[model samples]
Target: MSPTLEFSFRIAITVDAPTIVSSDPARGKRQLIPILGGEVSGALEGHVLPGGVDSQFIQPDGLCRLSARYALATKDGTVYIENNGIRRLPSAFTANLFGDDMGFFKHVPVEDIYFKATPTFEVDDPRLHWLTESVFICDAKRTPDTVNLDMYRVL
Candidate 1:
């Protein structure tokens, strides 16, 4: 049987500038984008805590592998999340196209890119324990200064 997806929640994450670590021809470019703060809504409602970061490895071909860690504060308790995903640039845009200008990605058409992630949740509150057992998938869109995600639970 085919699995179905149910809408879980949405997170609108504000971010600061990305710090480019290094550009290696063999390994790719590494960057860290800081998470400032944001809001969550839908099935889960909360505020995203500050100080989290999204670490990225951009390959020569413009494929980005990203891992983001952050926390959410709800009325009940806090939920820790680790989301990992891949983003593929449009065929017309290559890694060399942006070069050292990582900010150029902010202008890319979000609809044209393949950006998706699987998020794992950890929570201490028994009331929110359902989040720990379910599998989640998220679709992400990136703006100039924010990253928005719509999360869905797999069933």
Candidate 2:
């Protein structure tokens, strides 16, 4: 039988401007989006501090990939979460891509794109350390200024 996953909660993260680092024709487009600041609610509560970043890649095939590293500080202590994910855009959305106009990514219909990720937590506080021992998944969403993730733990 398949494993059952428990629903945790949603974490809405706000991001700052993305600094495009590379745009090589052979390699995928790379950009580093800064973590401006945000909050965590639902099962776990805390604030997402500044200084973390999401290093993203957009492949030539139009696939969107994400590599994000950030920290969360709860009332008790802190933990670091590393998230990796992939996004698939609807065919209609992909057909409209052009040069220098990636802005559409921020406004795509929520139902038109699919995003998913696996996240690992590095925890030091014993109370919250159980996070490091579980398997987690996130349904990630992106807006012009934020990233919304609904996380779940696999049991």
Candidate 3:
């Protein structure tokens, strides 16, 4: 059988407003999204401190590609996390402009977007040495102020 997956952890990432870097007709919309703070729960519990950013590229095909680099402090020590993913936002859902106003729209539920990410953890702490060599993937979701993720390890 092929290698299976094992639950790793869930990261609740807080964020500030995104800063759009550039709008290009051919390349797409470039963005630098600041990561404020949040927490990591589940198998590995920790906190996602501030001072990180998620770089996003919005394609005309409704797919937004992202490369997020951040740091997390686990019980073992500080671990650097690099997460890359893609998110699909339908035009109809994001047509209305709102800032953290998803709760008010009871008529529409959270956008059923296709979001997936591959996260790699780098740490020197012996307690979490295994994470450095592990292969992990995540299910990514985003709210106005937060990006919720559930990471799994290939086992």
Off by over 4 Å in 3: 24-27, 94-111
- 25-128 per-residue lDDT for model 1 (tens digits): 56788889899999999988999999999999888777899999999998778999999999887867765433655577666888987889999999989988
lDDT of 3 at 13: 93
RMSD of each: 1.7, 2.1, 3.1
Residue-level lDDT tens digits of model 3 in 57-91: 77755467899999998888888999999887666
Q: Which 10-residue window in model 3 sums to the lowest lDDT? A: 96-105
Best by lDDT: 1
Q: What's the lDDT for candidate 3?
A: 0.78
What are the lDDT figures for the candidates, one per model?
Answer: 0.88, 0.81, 0.78
Please, what is the TM-score per model? 0.92, 0.88, 0.85
- lDDT per residue for candidate 2 within 1-155, as digits (tens), equals 79887888677898876788777545667788889779888778988988999888878666878899999888768878899998888766654332444567766887678899999998878888778888999988877667898899998
Candidate 2 wrongly placed segments (more than 4 Å): 24-26, 95-103
Better TM-score candidate (1, 2) = 1
The candidate scoring highest on TM-score is 1
